[model samples]
Target: MRSKESDQTKEGSPSIVDSRFTQTLRNVQGLLKGRSFPGKVLITRLSGQLDESSIPPPAYLRSFSDSDVGPIELDNTFEDGFQSRSNSNASSSSSKMRTLSNTEAMSDQVQKSTMGARAIDSARLMKFTKELSTTTVILERLRELAWSGVPHQIRPKVWRLLLGYAPPNSDRRDGILRRKRQEYLDCAAQYYDISDMDRTDEEISMLHQIAVDCPRTVPDVAFFQQAEVQKSLERILYTWAIRHPASGYVQGINDLATPFLVVFLSEYLEGNVDGWSVADLPPSTISDVEADCYWCLSKLLDGMQDHYTFAQPGIQRLVFKLKELVRRIDERVSTHMEEQGLEFLQFAFRWFNCLLIREIPFHLVTRLWDTYIAEGDALPDFLVYISASFLLTWSDELLKLDFPEMVMFLQHLPTQSWSHIELEMVLSRAYMWHTMFNNSPSHLVN
Candidate 1:
């Protein structure tokens, strides 16, 4: 003879399962509310599930009220400070109960945060898709959207369009790409396919330098180290140098090609592009990728040819502008550097030459380029402000270090673990600084 409790337990099990199932449906419905056809299907399915009279209604779901959950907050406090305060209050059973309450609240916060992020990402992707779906893309609108950031899945197409390597008119896009790709092939055959005996002494020297630097480019990334990838780099660089005799080849120019290569190759591959094997692709496919990289790289360098030309006078001018801008924005940091006898060019030359590609991690390069390409012809002027913003980010640390230490620290900046959060902060600061200084002609004159 079992007790009444046993009967109750057996009877209540189905209700417990049904309640959980209903809660799951409610959550899914909340997620799908503003979505498309799938949302209608989910609503229909949920209505059928809710028809049972014995099943209770779901508990009223609380709204996710935190507005700051999705973005990277620039002014967040230290977690340790909050933890210390909480530790001080934990003294008795009641305090233990409060601790448990806090844990539940923290878990809820995390759930809401995750949901908020997903919603934001979904909305952004939809916006991009809508803009790109048109027969003729309005480039100004595309540039505005891309300036904020681009989604990874669609970044390749977006970069191509923004750089003018791909045509805006959908009707002309395919034909243009095919023509450009074939033109690149002809260029490769004429310039790169020739033997050393047929090449001039200067051409041979430049080819050797490019070959040497290709291996050294982004050495930390194994994707670049692949033999096929290196060969592609060599071909693109050499072909570009041969065509444009004015700038020819420069050491930092190899670093510039990397972002385009990674972006274009990502169109065909997925995952960490660094680990992808170019050899896995067909020869024709590799040639196409190389062609895209070459043209896009040329389009990019077209604006600031002096940056890689003899003596790189354009870079030197930008460096001077950065010094003046930094002086105006953060006088103390500038004074401290001057007191320590630190020159901006000693470190900022690399920043301007490579567009800070060497200064930041390889993965963040594409995200950074999205903004650079968006800047269009103004990139040279805007780059000075970006450099100043980047320098001022390390203002406090630079103030404490002497000249030698400053040189070492600036050269090997500790940015290996940096995520999009840090990079976005830098960009936001740069834009703010640009807005303040851009129209003021005298800001950089002194």
Candidate 2:
């Protein structure tokens, strides 16, 4: 009897499957007849199971709703690919169909959204080009553009101009860069080319510190690890330290020079900069890149010299200000932190020390600096607000964690995967907070 029942089950299984397939085909044909999609759709299955990973979440679809493109209609042929089933299987098949529909919609939206972003980027590039094309650049107009963001292609030139390393006047720019580049080479020879045996203990220590930090700087980036890139960084940092006795090769300053190096090197290389090797460039070109990076780094550090001097008083002061600022903005998070014995300096010191370079991904660093450089001398003050904004961005999550957990989380902020969008949001909040606090300083005071 058991053998006869087993035989019956096997004999009935194919009919049941065929019936479901026929029903699904009818449903798909109905859908296709009702819709006007003009393409053949092919769907194949290796097994009966569906790959859930292939389907995007509903939230992902909503994220791109603001794209300039019109709503994408579901392709009838694509919908026709899934066969229906009976009972619970029927429900599962319907969900699979919906997921496939959503997947295609999301793909369309993402493509359109990317196209829109590229269009905007191209427009921005054109604007920068037009502004830079003039014999004498309008500094004010250039600052306004640079504040929003600089195009990667023109960022090398824009950063120099913004930092006052390169002149705003086009004709003078070439002559000035030539002289400055040569001047940098001379400075390197005078200060950096010396043997360790001839150097003072302090000079030797600083050189050693820079050497130690060079490979450690942006370690995740393959570009920085290259022998040539590390040497360029060492020369740039050592020379800047020698020139600026007030803040001689501070640990975090190594991180600061990275943005300049990447930007300057960008002029000589293209595509994924992280993969580029400095060895590919001619020595003269490399020398020029190093010179530009040195000058720009110098210009950047000049504003916040005290931040790295002696005990880094500027950083201490900024951290204190950040604590106060957060207290005013989100007193709950502030009070909770104090109650938990958490100090802003514990985490924020690195943020200020590295200009949040250590906190964010390397790619977004240059974009963040666009606004920073645009702020000019105000960067130091503006930076405190930026730090406060950055800290408060994780307030909700931070509130949930205990002191030790908070410290660990902040020390290793989950920003390794952050993109330009997240970075822009931080900058936007910082700008808003800066504007609010500057106008009403009393709110920030005890």
Candidate 3:
């Protein structure tokens, strides 16, 4: 089989005029190829025109109720206490995102520009450490605190505790880390040795894909741009893939590994790890981070392993659910999308697969993960609701566009300026939506 990366190399760089068209086509191709449907004709229908009479009644129309779910009440003391921006106009609406409180006394635009690296709150940091030390692990309390946002400095240790990677017993912590880190290094010594001549064809192919994807994983991050950093990523991804042959080496898994890598790497750094150069770090420090990341990422993926399995059942179910959820939540947007012949998979596949890693900034992504791990095994189910709410966050803007424009808008949202505060708002709204509608059956009537 021809490799995906090799196909790109042979085509060379696409011209500016056809780039968007070429890119969108490639995206569609990848979606269809990655998934397994009955036939080629059935799959090709994804991009074809939708005839009104042929469209099935939306899944939610027959199932869910139109009754009002009560308004969401947010806590006032939550980090960067945010007020949801409201706009009556359509075109300017997506701009109406979560912003700092009025008492902050600055415009949202101004706040965005001036916001730098988030500072760790000493009280919260102390509180988290104390809670972690307690004999009885109060998970509900931890989830509440984590939902607000983990302090940046303590996030690495906090994540380990939250994910069950660290023991509840403090006495056993050092021994566990020592054993796990060495286990990873030993695996690397055996399987990841590039010098080995006996590497199988599948192993070679997996490594090639990892190498091609490593630099592209988090292109904007200065930390990920270094050759050494990319090699660390390569080892983690390749090692994980080789071990888990069932879901081996999916494209989006590469994106999923970065948050763990960065967060774990921060544990060893003196100051903000964002500005610290990877080349300046010792090889052992890098190896320790790689080991920790491998284990934590394994924990994360374990819940949603079906997502990257044969045909990605988890994503398929999610896109279907997202369509149904949107139909019930926002009829206009759903109707508009149906009229445009849009399948939820086109925009939503990456959303489910990567846990919105590609959509949000890295710092914010870690904060999001803090809540995800805290939420326990239900992350996959809850993410469908989050993805639905995230899509509708731009409903006003999406309602204004045509087919191609809507696709482009949904793919690259106006999230360039989104910070931890904005992320908190999105997650908060999603939690409300999930609570209200998740259990309401499609057969129920208002």
Candidate 4:
């Protein structure tokens, strides 16, 4: 909870000690580059355990026969503290990004089976259902699966569970969704049904702004470009704004809606449906997607309402924290940015406001959200670190630029085509940094 600025100032003068520690950390990080390990092994090694048993296998020994697939023994010290099930028996084609990275990146390609649509691991779903039945362990299990990225077929159900939109009780879930979906539709009707005389000036203003911003939300995506889709987004934003009143209809809120909309809609698709037209889907299906999106967006914003509230104090604090953390982690980059009169606010506002939605591709954003939504209330705080890692990922490119060029570079960082690989790298680096400096004292002085 300590501020990064205070941490730096408190470090006082430990230049030699700090340099030694930083170098040692960097050396370890260099050793880890492109080498994947079990979560426990990776965290133990990163935490400064360099013993032979703790060190990961050498590069040459990493190759395994395809027949070597088996259950992975996970270290309990992992982020969510759940043992992962090996997906070797699952068909590789059904495997979404979750299974792709979970098996490939976590176990170092030991399990490469595919999962057909609606064919997510039976054992996993059973465990999830059983856990939810207990009530006490539901959130924990949800976090585990969500952090690793939920399987595509289960994402809608998983999302509802995580956001508290659907009842945790399986038997009650359908009824809850039906009721909530109806509530959303009713809310939409109320907002849209207003005659000119029934609407207030502020309501009119908010709807107009939502209407204008809807087309601009995800303009490149064909689904969002549809007239019906645009109208849904407008209604969702307007309904949310009217409900919240204090932080109604911000530009970036539109960005937050896309991930929810896309994820909910994916439940109905077979595979890789990013380019599919929503217009091809039934009206009821589209309404269901929009309703789910509206509610999920509401759930997300509830925790960070201040971010969109007047003056955006939440984003300001986050931007400040990112700057502070960056200065501690990479003083040279920090100083270079300062010399160019650049502030974190200039670039990080979009990062915070939109949760980096605009910066990354949509598919990868959903992958990233697996971890984000899993983190729950910690999302706003975790984002500060993720934003710092993302910015510093381009430190070399950023340091070379002047003020104008740096601004442009920060705005468009060659991430348009980034896939799960790039996203995993960024998240991994951020996780490392978070473990090292989140609440700990910075060894180095900036």
Candidate 5:
């Protein structure tokens, strides 16, 4: 793999040829933008994603008397890979924010035909489930349903249901405030075992205090930053636990809450008007939500199946499957790996299980959530497509390296965040590449 030497090569010379090639690539990419399904999918995905947040209620939004909806500022740190893509979708609601430049703002709207906001009925769910991971098809649907230039009246309700955030009520502030007030609790003790091993009465008692029982106080941990964010997550998990007691309080539940928290509460957190800190987040709800988020993460991990990924072989098998797919698809890349003498697991392990968790931006994480939600079940195809796209796009630089450099190359990607447009372009290129190579008997879908 080659390190980016164009910088070094252009140092002394005027390099008209290099300049021409760069312009040519850009023009080609521009042309491919609309026609390319993967590009369109990635573009919409980036545009639609959001980070977890705990936004405070606005002055106008507050109810006549009580309001637990504090002013929230967006947590930029957790806003990492999931929500940074800046497209038209980053606008405020049409009813609010006087900033409505046009009809198209938020892509998600209500579907009157569907009973709930999820817009997905059993029939639709069945259709979606069957179509799981055809990356091209998934990307196509993403682009088709994109909120690119939508009006609030036309946006679908299914999105809100999928993301797990209740949409703004007619009386937005009061509804949120009322929900917040009810969520706080104080008698709970910490339940460190989110992995949900069998515990004795003392432990169950502690979990009951915070998690299962009433009067819970969840801590203000780094991930579930806001009280409201934590509370909503708690509701999701407690409800889940009631539904599935055997799988209660698993470790990775927090990860599941992340997408919803960021989306629902992000607006409040981004504010600095009240100048209140989350450090002042109420003790009861904060700690409770964290426990719930952690436990929900456990539920998600339970969904993943196998022993927890703490020290075990669960993730390893997924990594191995990814490696298998990669090896089958591009033996040249595999050959490059062997020639460079890189241990495939060392750098790529994080890529598979975490699904680029620490790698992309917050907004992109939202976009990923959109696709992940839409995929319903076929995760591997989505995973392999993105992994392959990342590697292939970076191939020019990656091909110039040895094992150490390759490792360094993959690790350094998160440093330079990709915009929705760029990510879409990469996927488009990969889609085209796959179209060309797929007939040759090497593809993940096969």
Candidate 6:
């Protein structure tokens, strides 16, 4: 029973209950355009804006096909319109990213100038170096945005900016991500604004059915590389929740599918499902967005089905159980915080709501994601790790907190509180500490 966070802890026998549910994220991440997989909050933010800017299309755009956008006419009418967004908008992003990238590269070169040419050896090193520079610049931009608490609606544009992906309103020449969003918006606007005079109720019903079946007819994986993938994935999820009625699309499901669609839209779009709902789409060529949505939803709910138990399932039970686990794991920290008079629900809501997305920094979110994927069916491990990390790292600060201040800090806690180094230390040691204490002969609750 040594703590998973223990620095000196050793491995124990692995938990059973088939852990692949969480591992699929790795698979989806591999298929996406980005270098890493982000957890829920970040991914949801990215998914909405992965293609919002007007920068040039990524080099990989060709890998995804026009069909991936669902139902495109031969002319692809929306393409030209997306590319021509005003220069005022894109100039800011394009110039900003370039300045940051250049400055970062120069800094690295200056630092390594002492090392000589030997440092920039392989093509890979050059790439890594370049990306690192990009990373620093991007991180700064993200920090500024996060600090401002940008509205979720406008975040998609910021995401494309960070990825160096073109924005949604840019010319088609810029990049598929941008091109795709514009297209999605256009299609959305058009589909949502059908001409009642042109179509009867039967026709509308037929269109919906057609939309549901389009993915079946159009087997394209390239779409995952573009924004269409996200839209399609979302549609699939919504459709599934509606179709199932039993599992009406939950909040976290969107969070789950957003990044997956960001990476594997092509794979998802190619698949089909029963009870698809394409009744509202355009004629003959509409996308089966609904079928694929359900399929993707099913895929997501594949592993974590237990957590979604309805009626009188495990919801409250899990919460209380987690409280017990936290009590056992770190009563001193918990008691200290409670003594400060902070209600557990105030700041703790975000932890459970998004599964700790806001509790950890982006880097650690990725790291936690990596570990999460590596260890499926390890929900308790994740929850415990977050708890253990928060307590252990912030114990110093907590001991000094008077009540209101502690609640204030927790309620509006910044992502920076969960720094990568601290997170790594926690992940490596928390489990160790937990197991060690559990196995202790006569350990008393602090």
lDDT of 1 by residue, 221-316 (tens): 999999989999999999999999998999999999999899888888878875698877999999999999999999999999998888999999
Ranking 2 against 5 by lDDT, winner: 2
Candidate 2 local lDDT, 72-149, one digit each (tens)? 344544344333212235567667766667567667766876787677667667878899999998877887777767
Off by over 4 Å in 6: 1-230, 265-300, 310-315, 361-364, 380-382, 417-419, 437-446
Candidate 3 per-residue lDDT, tens place, 1-446, comes to 78969756644564222343334334433433322211111111223332443233442111100011112223343324343433323324443333434335345434443332112244456667778778756766666567556766677877777777877677788899999999999998888975646798888988999899998987877778878888999999999998999989999999999889878877766665557777877888888899989999998899888999999998899888888877766667888999988889999998998889988767578777776887778888889878886887788798889899988987888898875445654665566556555676641232
Supply the TM-score for candidate 2.
Answer: 0.78
Write candidate 6's Cα lDDT for 1-446 as tens digits: 44546512212224311123112222232333222111111111122223324122333111111111111122222233333333336557775565555555555654564344233223323332343334233444342222212222223233333333432233442456434445544554444444756655654554465344434321333333333444465445434544444545444444444332322222232233222233333532234323322333354355456545464233344445445555554455667866767656566544554556545543244334433332334444356445555545565577788888787776655556544434444443444344444344243233
Candidate 5 Cα misplacement greater than 4 A, ranges: 1-160, 163-256, 267-303, 306-314, 426-446
Alpha-carbon error at 223 in model 6, in Å?
16
Q: Rate the local accuracy (lDDT) of all candidates.
A: 0.77, 0.75, 0.70, 0.71, 0.43, 0.41
Q: How accurate is candidate 4 locally (lDDT)?
A: 0.71
Candidate 3 weakest ten by summed lDDT: 60-69
Worst 10 residues of 4 by lDDT: 60-69
lDDT of 4 by residue, 175-235 (tens): 8888888998898888876785789987887788888888888776777787877887887
| Model 2 misplaced stretches (Cα beyond 4 Å) | 1-108
Least lDDT summed over 10 consecutive residues: which range in candidate 1?
36-45
lDDT of 5 at 317: 65
Which residue runs does candidate 3 get wrong by more than 4 Å? Answer: 1-120, 194-196, 270-274, 443-446
Q: Can you give the lDDT of residue 238 in candidate 2?
A: 93
Q: Which residue pairs come into collision in candidate 1? A: none
Q: Give per-residue CA lDDT, model 5, range 154-219, as digits (tens).
A: 112223322223223323534643453344222112223244564566445534543432212112
Candidate 4 Cα errors over 4 Å, as ranges: 1-17, 35-49, 52-137, 441-446
The candidate scoring highest on TM-score is: 1
Residue 279 lDDT in model 5?
57
